[model samples]
Target: MNSSSPIASLTKHLWSMMYYFVRTYIWLSLIMGISITFLMAHLVFWYLDSEQLERFVSSASQTSQQLHSNLVTIFTHSNNTCSEQNLITMREDLWRAPLIKDVVHIQDGRIICSASWGNLEAGLVLPKPTIVWPERGLQHWRAVKDPIKGDIQVNMVSDGAVAVLIVPDNAYASIPSNYPNTGFILSTEDNRYVFHASGPMAPENVLTQSGSSWRLLLTQQCNTSSKALECVTAYNAAPGLFGKGLWFISVVGVLSLAISALLHSSILFVIHQKKSLKRALRRAIATQEISVLFQPKVCLTSGRTIGIETLARWHDKHFGHISPDIFVAIAEKNGLMPQLSRLVIEKALYQASSLLKTDSNLHLSINLSMSDMSDPSLLSFINDHCSGHRIPAHQLIFEITENSASGFEGIESSVARFTSCGYQISLDDFGTGYANLSWLSKIKATEIKVDRSFTQMIGDQDPYNRNTLSAIFQLLKDLNISTVFEGIETQEQAEYILRHIPHATGQGWLFAKAMPIQEVARFINTPNSSIQHNADAAR
Candidate 1:
């Protein structure tokens, strides 16, 4: 075979791969576009409905406020005159205000005026007003005292009549024909209806409160009163609105189904294409595609390489390059993070074991997820792997994120079990979650990783940031837990930590990016590694 024929075949294979991805992309784009459109339309409708409801309620509340203000004005003016005639005039004025359903006035234990009946029963005698006081009247009185308006219902008896200014029960029942299905009923503090109006399409008996001033109830019904022109307008609009909503929903549903079918086809195509990609990646990993990159942690006081944080890197044969951030998220989503994590742990242990043979004092730290912790078989897996590989459990540390440890239900038990197994537990990203020193102390973590936020701000001249770090460092120190500062990218950051928090440990790009096992091994064997040089430079 010609040598160039193989190269041409490789080129054709690459082109086929590209064509597959492009086709998949087109299908995914169409599906995603449809999905996004439907979602956005639904969101818009939801938002509009919410806003409309709020506006309707707000209008009702404003109407109630006006009525209350009018009543209060009438009471204030009449109380100043302190005359039965004045009260009678006030009642008459309120009755003619178009919205007021009824008005009854009580003065000095006598019903001076009654607007609902259009007459005052002058010769009638009434019982004591105290009988109508609701049980929670005292609480209402306290709430309404002074600057706050009183909304409580109290019994008032005068001239053989019980006069109560009630918020009417059906205020929302009589709204004008043109208005939407919206109306409200206003009640006094005692839950008695004072004013009520209704519209043709309003909801039935929906009650809302107004900052304790009034209780508003609302309801609506379809208007079927007239077969004439005016009633036809309302009848036509109701069906139109309902039909429009239904049509929109139906169209969206059909489109969504189509999009889903397209998406399913596209996903299958992508999966087929990715099979080759995955196989190449697997082969690379089998032949050392997985690399152990070390980030150095230095002793703040001595500026020595006290520990190394291990990060995993992957390279694919067909895909050429891939980011762990992307693949890791994909792996987790695909339920493969456990397997990926196990591989990393095995490789890390094997490497750490070899390094330990040369230098027993070195520490190797790796990150573990909450899912890993909750795995019933994890402990036994670790035990088996470590024992088989001749790796000491004490030499490896597992870092757990604070967000993962939020619900401490099974965490304590899990931590205890791991600690008993000679595995060190470090709380990663401290001070960013509900995890405090009390929680840390309870869990009895061997180490706490101060979030990169604090480390990044350590060298800031700003007093607030400096003071915050100082307080956090002091708190961690008092807890007798070792502190590891993450994301130290500069010599200034290292120096600031050394000067301010001499007891804390530091780790970041200031040391080195994570490397493969062999490369890390080579660095460890080097007489003067970059990690040591950086530490010495910092000193």
Candidate 2:
């Protein structure tokens, strides 16, 4: 078997794991998103319907109140001592008033005054009382005790009469233009019609009385002219609006799910390709497919290289130069991150062990992801590798990004394990992703790598960016945790950090680009390399 057989198997396993995870995640997300959207639409429609009903009821009630108020005003203004002839004229005037259907002056429970409708003879007296008069022609009526004028006087010889006004039911039927389907009724408490207006009422009469007044009731049907047309249109359209709404939601849901499936398929395809690429890369690592690069971490004050951060580089025989970011992201997606991390640790440890024999003070920093922190076997792997190589744990620093500290289930335990084993912990990309000051004490990280955002803006004349960096550096200093400013590509940035945040250490292209392991070794070994000379001068 080839030396890389084990890595090939691991890569295949990683590809399988990634495919399942992506598929599951896509399915779950699409289902949830579509379901929520449909539910929200349903809730919106229900809310609109409820608001329409409430508005319709409110408008009807307002009209009724207005009619009551108008009648009370008219009755209060009338002279209670008016003679029969004068009462007849008063009734005629009131009957002509807008919304008053008919006005009848009742004197001693007799219909003495009425509006002339085809020689009906205004002020005609009726035998006995017209208290139980036929309601066949009446549209609507309302009887209200005039609060200001009090009740009308009644004699034992003659029952007191009420001034009955007959108004077209059209007044109450006048719904707001927006709600044409709404129906209304305005009648006395005893169901007497104040105005019987909706369409022609049936031949049935419901009579009831309030106090000494007789009231007649009639029923009218109401339908929205527009809604009736809309209903017909909707029915002819096969599926109605409600059904169409549901169908639209279903289509959206199906499309979303289809897209999710496609996405999942694409992810699987990429993951599978990555698995092959990783297999080839791992074989290269085992047979030297990957090359280690080192960037010296020089002491800001001393200017001597105190540590080197290990960076992985790859150049595939089939595919030319691959970026660490591309491969690293693929590795993470394909579940090969743990294996990759182990490989890096092994390579770094072996190199550090060799370097330590010559320079006992030299330190090696290796980057770790949140996945590595939760890996139960990671601590053991590190301990075993170091012990096998006879390297002290104190010489190694495990660097983790700020994101790893957020909701990291076993992070505290992992940190404790590594720290107890004499491995230094550094929080990398400190200003990014949940970089809480409180976590510094909790994780007991020995170092913090200030994110590129703050470092890039270090020399900016913008007060906002400058002040923010100043605050962050000061905060780190107060915490007693050393900070390394990342992405320093300019002389201005270096000067700014040195002057404003003198306590910080940094590494970037300004110092040295990550180079091949051989180049790194040669640079370190060079007696008077600019990096070494600068380090010595700074110290």
Tell me the whole-model lDDT of each prediction, alpha carbons only.
Answer: 0.58, 0.59
**473: Cα error in model 2, Å:** 2.1
RMSD of 2: 13.5
- My TM-score estimates for the predictions, one after another, are 0.47, 0.48
lDDT of 1 by residue, 256-293 (tens): 76776677677777778666655555555456566666
What C-alpha lDDT, on a 0 to 100 scale, does residue 260 get in candidate 2?
57
Model 1: residues with Cα > 4 Å off, grouped in runs: 1-289, 402-407, 433-439, 461-467, 521-539
Clashes of each: 33, 19
lDDT of 1 at 23: 79
Segments in model 2 whose C-alpha atoms lie over 4 Å from true places:
1-288, 402-407, 525-539
Lowest-sum lDDT 10-residue window in model 2: 227-236
